[model samples]
Target: MSKNPLTTILEANIFNGTNYNDWLRNLKIVLDFENQTYVLDMYLPRALPEESTHEERLTFEKWHKDNRKVCSIVLASMTNDIQKQYDRHDDVRPIMPRMSQIYAVPDQHIRYAATKVFFDTKMIERSSVQEHGVKMLYLVEKLGDLKADLAKEMYIDVILQSLHPSFDSFIVNYNMNGFDKDLHELINILVQCKATIEKSAQSVLVREASTSKAKGKGARCWRRNKGKTESTTASAQSAPVAPLGMGKGKRKAVRQSLIPKDVCINCHEKGHWKRECPKLLPNQAVKLISANGLQVVNRSRRLRQTVLKFSNGRVVATLV
Candidate 1:
């Protein structure tokens, strides 16, 4: 006598009408594996004394025992209300159908709900298109289980309808060449399309960033050039008046005007007096003054003639 295999295992998962089909299918597999599926079938009719044998009696007893065991396990797994309602029944057949009819939601309700979810589903901006497509396919499966199955074409159409306007070109191209593709194929194309769009957007952002950087650099360059131009103007404004063909009194007045003001006269730079200028080296200072078309004058009392030469070979005479 082989012991029942199901008795050795842990209790099966409780069945509520919610996942009745799956639970029932698993239970059937367990029963079949144990060679006790006869428990689910109708009981045999009573045998006459003349027709009955010892082996037949034992077989019937074993079948009845196995049937009672299966029923008890199923009842134990149910919720309180369902357990109480079905607990009195010792046979599997009556309990199975009654529980199914009482607990399972109507196919019409499931179909309507599934259809609503399928059509209302849209790809959110933050969510990947693949994830949205997956959710849509799951809803389609729910509809299929409720006997409202959609064809491949209908599935594609629903997904396309749910897409946002950004995907219009993808939708159009998909429609042109996607007649023979399945659900997963369509999802793959949408995913690729999404990646392409993102890549293009990233490229645009990079280009904009480059353009902004260039504009910033140009602005900085302009500011630098403007500062140089302003410094040149200030230097020219503070320049000494030329002493060409002027009298001693006029030369003295021009010398007074050439005295250092706010910035160095030699370098024309701020933050120091002309005598303290870093570029006031004997050779460099003369070259800088000559470059600016200016000449140095000494304040000696002797009437010595000093000649100042310019880059264009023009000479100016000043008396000191």
Candidate 2:
């Protein structure tokens, strides 16, 4: 065996029961660099030939040595549990295929997962459109790697559909113009559209703030006016009630009404009850003085009328 002083370790991520494809690719690259990849490609014979040449023996010995190295690299990359499963194998070729059987995902499942990424990804609140566009492109690239049957235009459509509703008009404009855009072109257009949307959103917020301020001021004014009206009514109600029959030139402000609810039995004038008339002295029947200085007194009777007499003995004033 030619010991060509190979010192390159497998510069690969550890395979923790997942990421089998990545780990496998890294393993191959490292093995190829070390000239040990043939150990994986060729199958070993059950035993050395009985009458083999020195060249055949050397080939078997070289293969056997490289196979051990490859197996060592594979086991080093796997987790403890997974390494135990493949470490028993003497041939390096079967180990890789066997590991693949356990860890490698099916093509259909990978395709489903990639398709789900396209549908599940979206531009959300407070997220940048540039980031959203870039992410969408990345997923499309992944799908392409998996040989997904989506066309280039379908990639553009999927990104547009996944964007926020603020881009609804932008999408419509894109479709109406019928422009063919690659992923990068779409991303560039979205960046510009994002700026426009943000500018318009700022302007709308300013207008809304102004409108709300106006509404708030109007509401305050209305409440102030309502309070003033209530205060005026309260002041008018609590003001002193004056005597009835004020002269037009000397009248005090009348609040509700000068008349009481009960009829005046003495004057029969309905302004107040029997003795409560302003014309009566306290504890006296209602009395009115005639032009001749004679006093007419009222004695309340069931009859509604009382007659008055003057000093000249004439029936001058009659009250009913």
Q: Which candidate number has the best TM-score?
A: 2
Candidate 1: minimum summed lDDT over ten consecutive residues — where?
A: 294-303
Q: What is the C-alpha RMSD of each candidate to the true structure, in Å?
A: 13.0, 13.7
lDDT of 1 at 231: 99
Candidate 1 C-alpha error for residue 118, in Å: 1.5
Q: Please report the candidate that would top lDDT against the real structure.
A: 2
Query: Candidate 2, TM-score vs. the true structure?
Result: 0.57
Q: What is the C-alpha lDDT of each candidate?
A: 0.76, 0.78
Candidate 2 whole-model C-alpha lDDT, 0 to 1: 0.78
On residues 145-191, what C-alpha lDDT tens digit does candidate 1 reach at each position?
78885687888788898987889998788678746787888888889
Q: What is the lDDT of residue 145 in candidate 1?
A: 77
Assess candidate 1 and give its TM-score to the true structure: 0.56
Q: Candidate 1: lDDT of 21?
A: 61
Residue pairs with backbone atoms closer than 3 Å in model 1 (clashes) = none
